[model samples]
Target: MANVAISELDKNCGKVVAEIVKLERKIFPKHESLASFFENELKKKNSGLLYLHVDGELAGYVMYSWPSSLYASITKLAVKEQWRRQGHGEVLLKAAIEKCRTRKVSCIMLHVDPLRTPALNLYKKHGFQVDCLVESYYSSDRNAYRMYLDFDSS
Candidate 1:
């Protein structure tokens, strides 16, 4: 069996951040990627990253931020192409939600491309409901669904 682990990314871990940046570039379009600003984002008190490793190799990560006590946003979730469809994304997502739960947040929100079926399914399976269709959320050609999981209602 593959050994799996999930842990919060430490701001001081430069090597890990670099690896994540490389992975981010591969997974997201340049205009939509937060890779260039990831380190800076991590430095913020309310922002953090959770990474999942399979057999000691980075498989996926989730970036989240809580700008206010009552709400949190999941800005990114990406699994390596080879690791896709293997439940790594779900694991990382669960970890991020748990982190928000521990902080007593009332709602967790995220935006996903409407056309990304696998991702939309994953979020829906975890109780995230579409609140609205965000036109041009990603780019001129791409639209997104603004989804949210309300802990108070669940």
Candidate 2:
């Protein structure tokens, strides 16, 4: 948490997407669409990404979307393998949640694969609850659980 600079996200934004592809071990966004998608979205929102850096190296990245909605959606979040279990994920999420709350967002939302136990647990520990399950949500070959956190809890 002490070694994070949200501004450095763009440097390794694409890498974070690649890392997610590796970590999830699922067929997703083989092309650079995911990475490029963030660029476009961020540009549209006039917002930026939040980056987590550890030991002077980029460790993770998260994309936040706040489109006149009450909830800020976490479009993506991923940490490098070596940086996991060090509380970086929590730190990144905290930063994002705070940012949204400061902007008057009522809540934060994110999605995780039901099969990803660790991710589900992490979200739960951070006050995110399974709001609902989206059938065939991810690429029609996978399902995703939408999680939400009320800003008042922060």
Which candidate has the top score in lDDT?
Answer: 1
Per-residue lDDT tens digits of candidate 2, residues 57-148?
76776667777667678877777777888888888877877777767888888888899898788889889989999988776778899999
lDDT of each: 0.93, 0.71
Stretches of model 1 off by over 4 angstroms after superposition: none
Q: What are the per-residue Cα lDDT tens digits for candidate 1 across 11-34? A: 577888898999999989899988
Clashing pairs in 1: none
State which candidate has the highest TM-score: 1
- Supply candidate 1's per-residue lDDT for 19: 87
TM-score to native of every candidate shown: 0.97, 0.77
Q: Cα deviation in Å at residue 60, candidate 1?
A: 0.7
